[model samples]
Target: MERDFDTTKDVVTNEVKAKKSAQAKADAQLWVVASGKGGVGKTFVTTSLGLTLSKLGHSVVIVDLDLSGANVHTSLGANPSHMNIRHYFEGAKSLQELVIPTTYPRLSYVQGFWDSWTPTDFSYNQIQNLIPELKKLRADYVLVDLGAGALEAHLNLFKTADEKILVTSPEPTSIEKTYRFIEAYMCHSLKENAAPDAFGNMITTLRDHRQRTLSKPFSFKSYLKEQTGISYTFFEALSQKPVRLVVNSCRSQANAELGHSIKSVCHKYYDLGIDFTASINYDNAVWQSVKSRTPALVAQPFTPLAGQFLNSCKHLIDPEELRAVV
Candidate 1:
């Protein structure tokens, strides 16, 4: 009777595990990680998050979409494969064929081209075509590392993601650039979805006005009221995409406060709710790991930075407040 009871318990445990595996696959998420500028640890964050998610038993693919400077392969201590995004663009390979397994189990990579042969003009139609194909990839989380700056292609990729994450450092310039990037994203989204005449004219007018008055701050709410016939609530609801911010290389408590300050200012000025999800501490181990081409989580799993990465991933999985507010 005791032997039979043990067998039943093992069977139940196996069944539960199988159910969770199936559910995780069914609920796959695509996350796009972008930054306003380079040297803000965007790739590090992307690789670490991918490793963390995979370690948590979720299959992950870290795609390098930084067309100008693709280096995600170096972050994972792997050499670039012949099959990359360039091949996909050249019609020599499918998106699935571009995937190259990394050293880490359950973690794959789709390398981008780093040479001069990289495609210069990625049309919107191409991006639209790529999105559905990317969704078909076999991974629980597809993390795309976008190029620095707010280029049209980068913005489109960010918009396509299920979760858009912006990485910024504690520096003032980085913060300012991040705000501008968010503004550009919101404007692009508005132009795409909102009525062409009204929204487009409003954006054009606002650009000219801002250029004319550099000293004055532009208020999105005020512009909406004065320029468009659209209701503020309806417009806000239409533009209500939740963006997650991760403050990288934070050293002091003041840095965390600065992140919150940026969030408050964005809400007040842009009427956009920004979720400041994680503050990664400035750790020497991160640099060491980068230098060695190993992920920080693998190099220093017990460090505070690793703990923060795990916490950030968890928050991203189910940001309750962000969901409720959005």
Candidate 2:
């Protein structure tokens, strides 16, 4: 059975290779969009961002890996279909076979499961395999919607991407959850990449600092520098993959600036610098587009929501752009 599976994968690889254009050979950049909790507009952001990119004449694919909430298709006005990731896992189709085009030109997506058991048990090994297949797609960008939470499985996908965009609202609960998610992600990355001794020391120091100064926030960077004084490689590696943050549902200038505040907290406490890429205002057009089952960029291209998505994509595509809290 293992041999048969390997043979099948090889065949799919060759078939995909044959179908690729010169542009596809360059490989698509994987942009993973996730949230610390649900109802933070993660899927909406994914669809809108992809739509904006497509308008720029870049081919984009949005994969609804958020199996539990799998509504990327609905948000993009694509009807339900059996062409989903579950079929790929069942060996019934290749990832390439599952690509379904959206109504918007240059945009496409893979439907996720609905009214069925979510692939919550999707293991790390499976993600490693899945990413290579995603890269084989003939697109300039592949936006993966990872739904929510800080589960180890989710963090693995989040950290493995070429770019990571974390979506959150300005609500207090959302802000708290986002921080917890980042902490979980940091711990996960440390465990995976740090030496056993170094990992143990840092973790212990973090816990001790929290206990001693319950009122004061713990900064892993300070402890690592003062005590461990031995290894800076892990943090240096983390610095290279700074997560991009997007604050959604902002109703005021203060709400929009929440992203900047979160960015400051992350840099100070976690020693991680995250880009405050966008702050989407609370606009009726956004939810209206959701009700119409069309992306805001497509349904109301002239709306402020569309403009915000455009800015988000610009910052994502070109990190050198001066970021401002919109």
Predicted structure with the largest TM-score when compared to the true one: 2
For model 2, what is the C-alpha lDDT against the true structure? 0.82
User: Lowest lDDT 10-mer window, candidate 2?
Assistant: 317-326
- Compared with the true structure, what per-residue lDDT tens digits does model 1 show for residues 1-326? 99999999999999999998787667458899999998899998999899888777778888888877888999898987777887777789898888899888899999987664635767888888877777778887889998899998888888878889999999988988898898888887766646768876777766776577535766777777776543455345534557889999998999866778888988776767888888889988877876887877888788888888888887777553222110
C-alpha TM-scores of all predictions: 0.84, 0.85
Tell how far residue 131 is off in model 1, in angstroms.
0.7
Measured on C-alpha atoms, candidate 1 has an lDDT of: 0.81
**Clash pairs for candidate 1:** none
RMSD (CA, Å), each prediction: 5.5, 9.7
Which residue runs does candidate 1 get wrong by more than 4 Å? Answer: 1-27, 117-119, 195-197, 208-219, 225-241, 318-326
What is the TM-score of candidate 1?
Answer: 0.84
